[model samples]
Target: MLPALVERYDYDPYGATYIAYRVPSTYDDASQTRDPNLLTDPAAWQPCESSRFGNPLLWTAQRYDPAVRLYHFLFRTYSPTLGRWMQRDPAGYVDGVSLYTYVASSPTCHVDPLGLTYIISPYQIEALIAELRRRPDIGGGLRGRTRTPSDQKAPTNGCSSPFGDAPSGVNFRGACDEHDRCYQTLGKSRFECDNEFYADMAHLCLAYASSEWQLAECLRWAMVYYIAVRVFGGWADLYDFLKWNGHARRNVSPLEPSRPAPRSQPPYTQPPYTGLGAGTPWCPSRRSPYGD
Candidate 1:
């Protein structure tokens, strides 16, 4: 009364190399025991070992260039025989070693997922934010002043704060209007939108950040606050004013923490990833710890 289901996989003698896989099928009748066309054929088997794409046995080998006989790894292209990359790292001399080295020529110890920058863990994020809060340019008391349209003519580098001594044309009223527009468009509270904007700016700043908190400070003073003062003229002062009065302090813990709390379990955990920016790891349904 129930349909019969069958699945099969064939591999090499060592059992480590995959050979072929048969599509699962359901049969209902007793006479359907054998399908002559289902015989295992060597030529019909998919090439799992040398193929360009999916190779169950070789998880690290992403792509194959048959012409060059090189396999593409995440951060670099690797030559199997040479045990090195064919070219130097595009990220330049990030680690101050040989540019051609793959994972510092230590494959067993390191993995580069995006071929770009190293991944920032949650702990690192906390450390960076803490350092940012200590900076005088960041957590220092706000400058209580306003700007007018006449003050907007100063040239700006498009990256630093437009307020204070280096006055820009950004007026306070325009800043308010822009903030409201961003809040309405994003469908978030003004504070929430500011937090999201900070996150985005922080992500961008990471590319240029050399140390902890540098990225956060860069985002705060160089990008977000800079743009605000550049466009709204004096809105930067008003925003700081609001911040000083605690009206704009919601969700700004990184920028200003009232007091340090006693240590407990870490608030964040690192997600499983092969390397920086590598994203989620792939595991077969049957082998997954969470179940199929």
Candidate 2:
């Protein structure tokens, strides 16, 4: 069997499932459309241009970064086994459900993680899901391609900083003046963002996290919390929200009872918070009323 990404349905009458990346094909970032009728009405799906990198599709028309481009490409290129086509059903909608038909091999419905069984070695289904999330492409030929950081040779100094603070870390020295600031200080590689260019890195990270089948939804919430903390005075605000006391014991074991039990005559009884008997031995005469 070809090494592929698979999704199975346990309850379907037909032993139907999906296998992605079964064939090696390049995906064209352009020429995709988001027509809804194609999903609701299979007849609406016509031939579209075949991608040299991915399974080719019949050419319906040309488009650039359409919302449903990924779905259109997958369904149009998918070649099911003989005598069977991907069935259209409400349950089949996983991620791209709004734009394509759902297929199943059995009738039993199951959830992610706990539902998926018998995965082969060295497989990560969540990462694959993350890559499938659609992001709006405002420009062309610069999204997924790779390059080194110093490719653009943008000026090391100027107005390219994201925060635009003169005290900011963008000053690389000896490259440009304040009017020609370098773009590397904006949280991207020096090569990726040179000349004030942005790559939608944040959206891409969010999409990757959202698509993972194994990652819980709470992770997304935690990310939101993390962002909020950074925006509003960072760790100080986070600590305040946590109600952390300055003197909270560090490295203490909760499993092993605390140093002083509540009934055992408080830790220190010195004058005005001076009860801590430093370098003094407890007098035997001062026995507890409750005995040892």
Candidate 3:
């Protein structure tokens, strides 16, 4: 995920945004042909402004909080299918999210209720790999330019080139064809991903929202579970637990450990959280989308 950067201009009065999956080469070129105008140009080969978020030409402010930017970038680009599913079935996802938040904020954190453990089975790992192979849209490109979800593969270890002659052992276990079918068949549906693995994923997300404990532990747990699930077989017990409990797992409060998440921070942000650095006031530009 790209960190948001502010660019200045002397000629053209207004500047633009640049949202890219991969940083452009110009940014690294010795000659530095990385002109903001060219990079953000609507006519550029990699038209970034076309994303669901407003056009770079017209949009003037980053919509996300600075701290959450990394969170959004990772989750958004890495788990588009999961993100979409969350949007489609928010009630279901919210149940898990809420439980995670409660655990994070609770005092006397003796045991991390949200810190889930799992042992990935080989079958699950193969299934995940198959899903990757199925996604040509994310993988098919020249040499080593392809990108996959952070959880799916690592580029440095050489998993980027899905079609290379000397394919890396880090290569996706399954093919893109299978990934497509699996994704399509399960789009926004309550299908089980390795259930044993989810306790860990849920914890990581909750960690992102908290500052109370050792989030690093949560991250480590997430990675371990991810590798296990993607490299080994899937976990059937976790899947059964999620299913048996139904799609929504209600969180119980101190008094009622069964009640739904006690309306924590409301789903929506109260005010737009434009990330202007502290001490410096945010002076909205008249022409900017976030007008004063």
Predicted structure with the largest lDDT when compared to the true one = 1
Tens digits of per-residue lDDT for model 1, 1-292: 4343232333222112233433334223333645545344333334433433344233242455545656565446666557656777665554335666554444433344434322222343344344334432331111221111112333333322334311211112232333334334422232222322332333334433444454434444534353343223335553664467352364233323112212441222212111111111120001111110
**What local distance difference test score does each model get?**
0.35, 0.24, 0.26
lDDT of 3 by residue, 1-292 (tens): 4443323222111112334433443343222554555445433234233344433222212132322221121112111112211122212232234322311121121111122321223343334334333542222221232222222322222112213211111112222222222223322211122221232232223323233232333333344334333322233433444345432244321111111212452232112111111110111111111110
Task: Write down the TM-score for model 3.
Answer: 0.18
Worst 10 residues of 3 by lDDT: 276-285
Name the lDDT value of residue 171 in candidate 1.
Answer: 18
Give the poorly placed runs of model 1, Cα more than 4 Å off: 1-49, 52-58, 73-76, 117-292
Best by TM-score: 1
User: Which structure is stronger by lDDT: 1 or 3?
Assistant: 1
State every prediction's TM-score relative to the real structure. Answer: 0.26, 0.17, 0.18
lDDT measured at residue 61 in model 2 versus the true structure, 0 to 100: 22
Per-residue lDDT of candidate 2, residues 128-247 (tens digit):
223323433322222333322222444543323222211111111222231123232333322222211212222223323323331233233222222222222233443443355232
Query: What is the TM-score of candidate 1?
Result: 0.26
- Residue pairs that clash (backbone atoms under 3 angstroms), model 1: 128-213, 152-169, 169-233, 170-232, 170-233, 170-234, 171-232, 171-233, 171-234
